[model samples]
Target chain A: MDVVVDNLGVFGRGLLVSIQISAATFVLAGLLGVLLTVCRISPVLPLRLAATGYVELVRSLPLLVLLTLFVFGLPEIGLIGPLLWTAVAAMSLYWATFFSETLRAGVRGVPLGQIEAARAIGCTFGQVLTQVVLPQAVRTSIQPLASLLIAVILNSSLAAAVGVTQELTGQTQLLDQRYAQPLVTFGAAAACYVALAFVIGRSAGILDRRLAVQR
Target chain B: MTVTTEAPVQRRPLTVRLGSIGQQDAALFDVPGPQAQRRIAIATALSSLALLALVALAVRQFAINGQLEWDKWQLFTQWPVLRYLAIGLLATLQVTVVSGALALPLGALLALARLSRSPLLNRPAALYIEVLRAIPLLLLIYAFLLGLPTTGLRIPLFWQLIIPIVLTNSAVLAEIFRSAVKALPQGQTEAALAVGMGYWQTMRLVVLPQAIRMAAPALVSQVIRLLKDSTLGYVVSYLELLYSAKVLGEFNHTIIQSYVVVAVVFVIANLTLAAVAGQVERRFVGRAHRT
Candidate 1:
């Protein structure tokens, strides 16, 4: 307990980095996810196949493997960047598959009759997607997307393994090494994660309630 | 108009319920008109070209860095190197199985506790699930790695990895179990109670069997996640596949190739597990339809 109290600044900074990484990954993954979702549902055969393949491949690989690869393997291809950005890039690329899957599920939840009605009304394909499918999909997907955000935050800790030590988990490891108080340090870090998850879950619940279209 | 009959309610197979992607696309859009078809063709060609260009650039980069050299990858052809990785893979499986065996039953108990009528059981169970689910597995592993030693307790590397995997996954599995039990029709419990069965007996004799069957597919999917989580063994200095790859990579001076090989192995292993999950789902669905 004293260890945590004394290392307040370290924990605070760690939490901040975790939040930043989560936020950036959420937004970037969301954008890429939407693009993949569109490509997935597009009429283009090759585009759909490519997007599907990407999702399948990404889903099968673990985040840690991907992180290590990006950290160590990217330099071989001359695509080096700051460690923080590299971690973000890997997370975004990985979570985008999950996001797209959620969106696809949301799109599926939209009643077929509604899409048919839009088409019968002579809406263009693009218009039908923009005006009809997307609005409902986004609403239905709020909870899953929220879960994904929490997932991104939790996974950000893997950044520590790849040498991004400013995140919560990494900071705890550093603190533990210095203080030799593993229980106190790691427990504090765990509490911080729970608090973050709780706050996000609550906000998402409110958003879901507000945005849900009543039948 | 002809007289109409009510349609029977259809139960989706567990595979569909598990939300496999790309299958729902056809419902999202209409069959293309002539203009739409032409546009789709053009888009396909353009996207194909872009994908091709991306692959080409990646290949060129590899070529420039000598990463494409056959020598960098040839070590994988040797029997000794392959045997080393296989042993690491075997160790990874050992942890996954040991942890999974511990988690599933513990998860079932947690689910029961969370669903109990007593707040003593229910509240604490809920808290455990929520807190465990929220914390990252890596942190839990770290807790075991760094924290336990301070209490004057020292465990082996395997337990260090296994304990965290069990702790984290049991919570998730508890949720899966609870949801499956909830999804059972209200009539199941009502019927059991009407027959004078006690709560525990009713849960054991009636609810659990059905719920386990219902949860089987999801449980299999969770195994995939458990397998992935076991890779965190690298952090504990456990001799798991990823850790072994790092060692081998250093010895061979083929870092990229070794990691990529391990990555491929993981992909194949997981995909095969997923296929098994799909099969389990199909069997359950088939049994349900028959009854």
Candidate 2:
């Protein structure tokens, strides 16, 4: 018990790193996802095709492969950085593809008649989008977006595979080595993950209820 | 500051483009105007150039690093290398198959318990699903790796990966099955009961089959996930594809090449699975429409 207490600091640091990576991944992937969705739905045929290609290509490969490529392949081009950042970049790219698909589904879910009505009411294309389409799309998208975030958080555990030691999984692994108490150390890590997942899940549920559309 | 200067409303050309795109038929959108065609042509040309430049840069970097050695790839043509990769592929498939076979019934059982009337079964099933879903597959894998041997069971290392995967995947599969079951029209279950079938009989014959059919596409995709996930076997030195890639990379001093090869193999395999799932889903949808 004392040993476990003593190891809290290490676990805490790893947890912090995991949070930092996940937060950055969430923000970056969100922006990229929106961009990709826009590209997907844009008038530019090439852009749409490119976005589709990118998503499919990324989707077909495993995240571990992407991480390995970034870890081993980045330095070749003089793009050296912290292991965590590299992993984050790879992960964000991997997730942005899925996020784009999710957002695209949301965008498609919006009723076409609403957009036509907004346009008939003298709304510019931009106004129709910002005022009418995007709001509803975003509202419809919250559940999926939350699930995507949960996936990012869960997948961030793979960062440890690439030697990013400042995450919950990494820290737990380190402690497991030192204390030789796999059940206790990993069990503690599992508790932390479950707690984080619950927080995310509960918040998503609250937002879903609060933002429920009155159809 | 006395007179109000009109700052231009920054035109969101992109959003406008998206709106226009959405309004038009995706294929026929190109047939309308020369202006649209030219715009598309210019965009394509520019994007192509950007892609080419990115590829060129990567090529140059690899060239400088002397990682473009033809000999490094030749090893792939040899029997030993093929055998090694085959072994890794076999390990991955074996784990995915065994775990998947186990997960289906376990998941169905979990789903049944969750949907059961009794709180005793319901609460624990729900609890198990939520807790297991919250846990990362990696952590579960690690726990099994470290904890299982302590039981003094001389279980093979392969079981370590398989057991954890089955446990985690069953929770996920349970949810999929639950959703499928819930999505069924209430009439089916009630009709089965009306025919005087027992509850379990109704579930086994009427509910479960239809639900499993509805969930087949999702189940196949989940199997693809299991395939990719079996790569985590690298952590415990289970000699899956990724681990084999690492071994080959270390042996040949061609880390990036080995990873690229492994990635290609995974991509092809997963893409094939996805294609199969797509076909199955279409067939199911088509059958429903016909019926």
Choose the strongest candidate by lDDT.
1
- Which residue pairs collide, candidate 1? none
How many Å off is the CA of B96 in candidate 2?
1.7
Model 1 stretches astray by more than 4 angstroms = B1-23
List model 2 lDDT by residue over B124-164, tens digit each. Answer: 99999999998888888877776666766667888888888
Candidate with best TM-score: 1
Chain A TM per candidate, in order of listing: 0.96, 0.96
Taking all chains together, each candidate's TM-score versus the true structure is 0.94, 0.90
Q: Candidate 2's residue-wise lDDT over A1-215, tens digit each?
A: 66568888887888788888999999999899989877776666556767777888888888988898889767754678988789999998999999988887787787877877777778866787788878888888888988888888888998888888778987887777777788888888888888888999889989988987899
Q: Which pairs of residues have clashing backbones in candidate 2? A: none
Q: Native-vs-model 1 lDDT?
A: 0.89
> What class would a CAPRI assessor give candidate 2's docking?
acceptable
